[model samples]
Target: MIDFRYFLVSIAAIFLALAVGVALGAGPLKGELDQQLRGTISAVSKEKDGLRKQIADLQEGDKYRDSFAADIAPDLVKGRLNGQKVVVVALPDADNGVVKGVEQSLTSAGATVTGTVSMTDKWSDPSQRQFLEELATRLVTGDVRMPDNGSAYDRAGVVLARALVTRDAAAAGRKDSATPTIMGAFGEGDLVNSDSDLPQADLAVVVAPPVQAKAKPTPDSDANQAWVSLARSLDSASRGAVVVGDPSAAGDGGVLASLRADKQARGAVSSVDVADLASGQVATVWALAEQATGGVGQYGAVGTTDGALPKRPTAGS
Candidate 1:
């Protein structure tokens, strides 16, 4: 009769506390408790890492913050469009930055420039490959003239392409036999399109490799069929020149030799290896299908070098 209800309540609370204590200490809940602790530790570790990064960033200074447009504006005013346009196209990422750099530099140099800012990533598109291929093809062919672009960068490409074409053309003309026809594969799978605005020349300058072996390999049967088809089509059109750019993967092995042999009766085959090489002799072996007609061209050695192209300056320039 000494307040039984109060004593009962005290007992229930004590039992609940004991149950919790057992769960935490060598009980079923021990694993769950450890997992919670580990999670907390991991969260703290990540926070520490984030803080370290912030400190590093502060130490590095704010060099990434700079104007791109201010740099080109001055050149634009001085009629130095070539260098400016080249710079702009190469650093298309810095569209606004370039515009800003140009504006500032031009204004300081007593010139006014105006243009809409376009900051888009154009290279991400796959069509760029085709565009570049087409441009390269045109450059290799002396017959086609590059269109004149008002922009400086476009003009640069045209100039460079024309120069290469002249050099390559002279080389092709001097070694005159019947002009060899070249067929290249630009598409994927079996649906390769042999018919395009490809050049028809005696020397098919395949722009697939940067540096190839002096000894050209033979083409396969399937490749041979495609080459035959291309040759016949060219023959019917009365085109004297046959040139190939960016050869298909199948244009290897005996197939090339067969093409050469077939042409030997009428003319000679002149091939250029476009495979990029690193640290090896650029060797190309030419083999004729019937008569082991073969020749080789060795190129200088190359290496795995980075920074093949120029880079944009940071905030400090």
Candidate 2:
């Protein structure tokens, strides 16, 4: 309804307002805007530098802690195991350094290191579960009772535990069933090999690494249950069992992570969650010593550990 002239006038007014705003920004606000930008850049730089320094400081502290733990570890673990015999079992992805450290810690504590057992990654694979079940069924003897747990891994674990460990003192004298035939079968399958004389060790230290997170958890995601079953079976079979692991193993998918969480197993075996550290290694030694006396506790930096170490083993225990 308006004339064309009125439309043009409105457009002109809009342009005029824009021009004034530009002029004011360039003429008056330019210095303030530049100063604000400079201040923001400086503040960002300071924050970045502070973060870098903090990271460096944390790294330094870690080095100091490791050194301190190493220095005192030998003294702390000395004579703790006196005359005990121990077998070392390395699970898949286990740290070689931690395994060596565990042996050192145990040896320092006066325990005999019979040898080491290295388990293949395939040992934990769900695909091979049927094979393990078949093997377990074949190996299970008249005296050995298969566990009622539905998991094939659990069934195998119990069968293997019965074959490997001398649970009964009276059975220790037997000639045929006393020796573990499962070791020979394991060697045949190439699932595990050990230097341990098929060792009838009085104590077992099952070493497992941290459980890494790669995908969203599904039913297949939690292989740590296998470890839990094995540790429980091992604990029942041996005089004592101490399942030691890295922090990750105590994390989301961890096996020993639930050692404290599972009320049924908590009182029967010992566990240490920080096996990578000297403090953790020392704790493991004390845990083994503690277990020898029929007492059990969890110790570590992660899930379910009571403290950094278990109560000191009593004299002559």
Candidate 3:
């Protein structure tokens, strides 16, 4: 007789066949799956196209803004700094294009560009701190003293600042003149180079850009602090001083960011953080003019800027 197990096996095989058929129907055999996938892809493509168009519109708007600013810049800066003498100091990482743009604006504003000084990376290198201290003593030949008690970089900054800056050119006289000594010393040591003939200047403007530190540094040990000290000292020594950088300087760990955070330095010197373009460079010159008149302000698109530029002087107000 046929075993009962044979019947059980036959029943199990029938159930398995039915399960497979249902699973296949739910999967690749499903009629609507392909159409659903196509619909999803089409929706995504439409979204991407819309986003592209939006980006293009924004870029075109930016181009128009830049063009408009360039056209109006000259009229805004006419005779702003007439008969003033100015000097440019470019930090190691400062943008050459921006620096040149700034020079052009100063010229357009009727300010004499005395010269430009290009600083080397060694100016702020921690590894050369001791050497900088010795060089600082050698470079500064005048009566100017460092009140910070010789933190190498700080002292060096004070020396350099006093050399490049001065309160009154005529009253102070030759005894106060440190430019020749400083230039000779720096030239001999290769700390700085005059991009052209150096002349006496009544005001100073420093061109710096946002820069990353080489490595992890203690709170006050970073190279950026050197710039802060230099800006402060230069402001004190000169009739006016202003620092010009880009919008990037508003970011974390930027030189302008640090300078703005310092309460003492903030008011001592003026700043314009968007000096990359013609309009911004005009703002930079105007800020310098304001500073020379014993005023301080911040002007930039971002960071600690007080406004786009100082308010236009009213009719003899």
Candidate 4:
């Protein structure tokens, strides 16, 4: 609305300022600005390189530790569980490598692995609760007493535990007439899978799924609690039972984490939360041996009030 000359002058002034800035950048300030930018890039690159080296060092350290643990694992657990019959139960998504490592560790400790029982996803599906309840009721033998009050999974746990473990040494490693029937029923129901007949064991190792980075941490979800109920039932029915999982399994929503949070279950069940590592496998075997003697502890890198490993029992005592 004002004079056209004033608007033109204002535009010219802005352009002049920009021209001056460009000249400075290309001339007097050019070297300084370039030097500053180069310095910044160099500093950032150095930091990145430093971080990479640190990560490499950590990885190498871990590799060395795992190697050392594997070498000494046999001696560490030698005769610890001599003559004990142990069973491995793999929860859904359980790491096969870890399960195999645990089996080797148990063998090194002189415990006979009866068989590996793999739980299907149906075990944790809420929709299958009614079916599981019916199955448990139908398959429960007279000798196996059902819990008066608990979830359907609890009843199923009792039935499954009765078939897989026993406190009596004579009964262990010996399948009774009902053993195959019970296992077969669960297998047919698509709740459990086993490669061969699973003899009753003196102790049990329940392998939980490894830590899932993307999974929402639902520590108290019905599915997770179902597993907890099952584990508790197994512990009650067996000589002792230990739940093993990877380190993150002790984080939020992990089955091992849920077990640790439960006051009653934690009191009865021993947990090892680093089963993915050789050291953790060794700890798992030791935890089972501890269980054989009425000891309960949570051992691992995370969520563990107990020490890294149970106290190694002295000879014959």
lDDT per model vs. reference: 0.30, 0.77, 0.76, 0.89
| Weakest 10 consecutive residues of candidate 2 by summed lDDT | 169-178
- Give a tens-digit lDDT track for model 2, residues 84-142: 77778888878899999999989888887766888776667888988988877887777
- The residue-by-residue lDDT of candidate 1 on 1-317, one tens digit each, is 67999999999999999988986777777888889999999999999999999988975653332123224323323321111111011111222332343334323333222222121222122334355345334334444344443222232233222221222322422321211121122222111223222222211122121113455444433333333333322222221212111222214442223344454412433222212211010111111111011222212211211112112221211
Best by lDDT: 4
Superposed model 1: Cα runs more than 4 Å off: 1-60, 63-94, 109-317
Descending-lDDT candidate ranking: 4, 2, 3, 1
For candidate 4, report its TM-score: 0.93
Tens digits of per-residue lDDT, candidate 4, 164-266, equal 9998977888986777888989999999998536788989999998767877558898878988998899899888999999987888888999999999999
Judged by whole-model lDDT over C-alpha atoms, candidate 4 comes out at 0.89
Question: What C-alpha lDDT, on a 0 to 100 scale, does residue 88 get in candidate 4?
Answer: 94
Superior candidate under TM-score, 2 versus 4: 4
What's the true lDDT of residue 122 in model 3? 80
